[model samples]
Target: MNLTAPARRARRAALLVPALLGAAVVAFLAQRPLGGHRAGWNGWVGTVNGIVFLAAAALPVAVLAVWALARRRRAAGAEPGWARRSALAEVGTLYGTAPWVWMILLPGVDPGGPRRRVNLVPLHDVAEIVAAGPPATAAAQIVGNMLVFAALGFLLPVRFAAFASVWRVLALGAACSVLVEAAQYALRLDRVSSVDDVLLNAGGAALAALAARRWWRRA
Candidate 1:
């Protein structure tokens, strides 16, 4: 029998978003090192830059996941709407910023790493040029971060013009960054809270919001 509207939407998220996100993850891993100066393996796209690119690319998947699941939740079935909760979890709260969490590699302390009161290094304070690279790398990382959230903002189901303002979303995003940094610092988990990350993240959000604005207008 044909299901209800909610069922179709839930199925859509489960089918479409996951398929897209899975493909992306596969492509990203296939393009390993995703950053820089890495030798190619099996002709896959290897480089640190890939990492930066993947970080941003994941944004669409996250958005789709949230919307799809949110839609699914609106259509409940057995199991207390497990489908909806699952979708909510996939996109809600910390999805956009998870990449940064992974980047920090705070699994534990490095005995040789420097001790810091907080990891909050101001975004501008971070040198655009590191021993391994130039501003492009730094810029990429920042862009990725913002795009992640901006895509999130777009998919967040908040379709109102005023509520969807870039300034508001960016502000909310920056506050989120601050809360994350504070948590890291307060826990003394050895994660440095750099103010620079906050700046880059906010900038990323703004840029994404701008992009979203354009796309929205077009749509």
Candidate 2:
């Protein structure tokens, strides 16, 4: 049966609600726990308190921005759906992904040690980390790397037509990962730049994009 525009929109929104929730759950599972034994490892990614405060502070600004955009669209006799969604997605994208970027940019402490490390061979570092590191540390590193760009992957297609395809999301994630890795190397942040990071990050982006495939903006 054919559905009217509003009905179709509502149905799509209904589907999106669950997909978004699943994305949140997946992201949550990929991170270090918020409290308990490992809580002190609260590096940038683990800094739940700071990230929550930032997100909370940004919410009102996003809401007001969306309201203003909707008012402009209504003044121009246009449907506010696109305007509202665009505004929300734009704000959400920045708000959700900024913490990851901040985390990546934070310098590791190594006052008396070598400044930088690099691993060019694909899968080499990944295998080593998995084998040599504690199980919990290895899991946290792998999952954290994957989730670095997962929010970008999940939200980009919903906001922009160009990112609707899985490959685009993959490429975007890889490129962004390269930038972050490069920065780490250049700044001598005592971090290892690894090919495995690019691989897992791109994989995460692809997986997240797939989750939002139904809601992707069409050309």
Q: Which of the numbered candidates is closest to the native, going by highest lDDT?
A: 2
TM-score against native, each model = 0.52, 0.70
TM-score of 1: 0.52
Cα lDDT tens digits for candidate 1, 151-209: 45553323334535777767866876677667666556665567776776666666666
In candidate 1, which residue ranges exceed 4 Å CA deviation?
A: 1-105, 111-114, 119-124, 128-136, 157-162, 214-219
lDDT of 2 by residue, 1-219 (tens): 999999987996797667556645554554434544455555324465545544544555665676687678778877667777766677667766777777776667762366678899999988988999899999998988888888889889998999999999999999999988898888787778888989998899889999989878899
The alpha-carbon lDDT assigned to residue 108 of candidate 2 equals: 70
lDDT, candidates in the order shown: 0.57, 0.77
How many Å off is the CA of 125 in candidate 2?
A: 2.7
